[model samples]
Target: MTRSAASVPTFPGSTILGQFARSLISLAKAFKDRREVRNLAEFDERMLKDIGLTRSDVTSALAEPIHHHPSWVLVRCVGRPAEAHKMTAAHKPRPVVPLASRV
Candidate 1:
């Protein structure tokens, strides 16, 4: 009989520590997201509209649970020229090097 690496049982102590680490990471992410949403609240109505958001939308997002991602609303908004350029840059494929030259 063959056993794959995935079949190995995890140590109970390590499992507990891993879960604790994940919780800490999640808490940190929630804090950062809440801060970003608060910053967005400072934008005036016209600026919000330009970003395809209403003042009400910002309010609603702020009211959501901290674990909820409010940035999704901003992501769905119309992209400014600068933002569009950033998106294009992010998606641009990396140049591939020949295997022989990699060494």
Candidate 2:
């Protein structure tokens, strides 16, 4: 007895339902991140600054499109200073120790 193609079982992981579920999960994550970013706005400037962010950074991040992750903007804003510091530190010359001093 041969089974018809329509009678075959399809794995849920490889079906449209799986893709739709994954998309829904991603959307939920984005919404959660957005809410967290919004909460950051309530923090004082000093608190924000302690985390390497500013009021303007929070405002700019919040201004991004709803679908986009606002936390990424904040990450970029916070990273800029650290990256700049790294670049500047890289350019500084290190002092050389005299080989003859090691007796």
Best by TM-score: 2
Q: Per-residue alpha-carbon lDDT of model 2 for 40-95, expressed as tens digits?
A: 99999999989999999999998998778899999999989899999999999999
User: Which stretches of candidate 2 lie above 4 Å from their native place?
Assistant: 1-8, 11-14, 86-103
Query: In model 2, which range of ten residues has the least summed lDDT?
Result: 8-17
Worst 10 residues of 1 by lDDT: 72-81
What alpha-carbon RMSD in Å does predicted model 2 have with respect to the real structure?
7.0
Write the residue-wise lDDT of candidate 1 on 1-103 in tens digits: 9999989988869978999999889878877887887898999998877777777777777777777677765555444446887999999999998777555
TM-score of 2: 0.66
Residue 100, candidate 2: C-alpha displacement in angstroms: 33
Error of 2 at 83 (Å): 1.9
**Top candidate, metric lDDT:** 2
Instruction: Give the whole-model CA lDDT for all candidates, comma-separated.
Output: 0.77, 0.90
